[model samples]
Target chain A: SQTIHQWPATLVQPVGSPLSLECTVEGTSNPNLYWYRQAAGRGLQLLFYSVGIGQISSEVPQNLSASRPQDRQFILSSKKLLLSDSGFYLCAWSVKRGQPQHFGDGTRLSIL
Target chain B: AQSVTQLDSHISVSEGTPVLLRCNYSSSYSPSLFWYVQHPNKGLQLLLKYTSAATLVKGINGFEAEFKKSETSFHLTKPSAHMSDAAEYFCVVSPIYNDMRFGAGTRLTVKP
Candidate 1:
């Protein structure tokens, strides 16, 4: 069974602070990883996705960026956070393209 | 390109009543569709997925959805609503590998 892990379960950050959220998958190899953000009263917006190590595609232009350092390790980071960056961030993994994605327990980020 | 639309932003249903959450999608090619549920401040969980095999797909927790290519719809339903079913639901569409789109989620409220 594949499992995705994300942390910290919740985060509170000040404006202009740095942000880094990590995601890793177990029991799978070369999986596709994705980063998504869900705002209040809105659906999820894909921020980034990675096919392989050091390869990332940005779905929407935003202050956040993603990286894949290992085959199953993905990281979402920002140099400086904005108030608009506050949201529930999710990490997902899929065995292949166009397949069902498995999600991790999201990180609720609040910016003050 | 692929896009998804969830018919209603919010739906309220009484316990023991049938549940219907409508979803429609568009794609250049045969698309893959999925439904996911999100509890308050939690990550999205896969409810069901349509991959061109079965028209009617059964998922976890007594949830099911029928894929209608003629209507470009994949509507989710349950015979009886449970309070635990109250959550945000998302409709997703994918035309190709790594190109997934999400609908503005539908919030399901099951009343006792």
Candidate 2:
């Protein structure tokens, strides 16, 4: 059985502050990791995805950046956050291409 | 390029009635389709998937979806609706690769 863990289920950050969200998977190795953001009354938006460690792909360019430090560890970071950065951030993992993805509980970030 | 479109932005149905959420997809090749459910304030959960093997796929929580290649649609269906079933549903498509795309999502409301 595999499980994904995301830290800081809810976060409140001030404008221009830094942001870091962590995601780690257990019981699975070399899985594809993804980062998504969902705004209020909107759908999930892909931000980044990683097929392996140290290899990251940015889907939508913005202030956020993602890094895969380990085989099953992914982190989303930003040096300075913008007001539009506040949203529900989700971390997901998939076994291979065209497979179903497993998602974490997600982190609700509020920037004020 | 792969994309998905959910026909309805929001659907309201009475409890114990049949439920249907329409979805259409576009892809140059054979596409892999999926239905995902997200409860309020929770992570997205895989409901079902169609990988060209079976046109009708059954998923958890008594949900099912049928894939129509000619129509390029994958519509979710359930025999009966429950109050607990009220949530947001997303239609996803991937063209034999890991580049998964999600629709805007359709919010289901179960009325008593």
Candidate 3:
């Protein structure tokens, strides 16, 4: 019985502003964490993934970066936001590689 | 490396009718496949997965998919479509020790 929590479900930020989104999972230990973005009318794009604390992998290099400071805590942050950064951001967790991932409710970020 | 292709970008089906969404994948070895559904502005929900076990996998909401090795296909189907079933569907392929590859996604529209 694991659940993921994502904060700031809806965010509106001005251009060049900083951004920070948090995601944490409960009832799971040492799970793989992932960050994904979904643009309007498009599929998801993997931004980053972490197998363990302080072990982050970038799937698609972009303005966004992710950090796994704790075993079940992941944070996505950006020093300055761009217009292209506006999208539905999702955080997912999986028991391990080649396993099904459970997704959080996601955060709708709109850059003004 | 693993790649997934969702055959149709959008599909319209009448209520109570059979529903079908086609998907194809490419991988060097036996890959893990999954189907997920997402409502508008919502996170993904795992429908089913194929991990070289059962050829036919049943998922929630009365949806199921069959894995075809020769064709490298995993097509999703439902006996009867419901209005609530209208959403976007995704096909994903996860190779061993690699990041998961997602398809372009196929949007299923259920008409009354």
Please identify model 2 stretches exceeding 4 Å from their true place. none
Error of 3 at B102 (Å): 0.6
lDDT of 1 by residue, B1-112 (tens): 6789899999999999999999989887788899999999888899988888999999999999999989988999999999999999999997766556889989999998
TM-score of each: 0.96, 0.98, 0.98
Better of 1 and 3 by DockQ: 3
Interface RMSD of each: 1.2, 1.0, 0.9
Please state the CAPRI-style docking class of candidate 2. high
Q: What is the TM-score of chain A alone in each candidate?
A: 0.98, 0.99, 0.99
Give stretches of model 1 more than 4 Å off: none
Backbone clash pairs for candidate 3 read: none
- Which 10 consecutive residues of model 3 chain B have the lowest summed lDDT? B93-102
lDDT, candidate 2, B7-98, per-residue tens:
99999999999999999999888888999999977899999889889888999999999888899889999999999999999999987766
lDDT digits (tens) for residues A21-97 of candidate 3: 99999998999999999999999999999999999999887888899999999999999999999999999999997
Clashing pairs in 1: none
By summed lDDT, which 10 consecutive residues of candidate 1 chain A come out lowest? A93-102
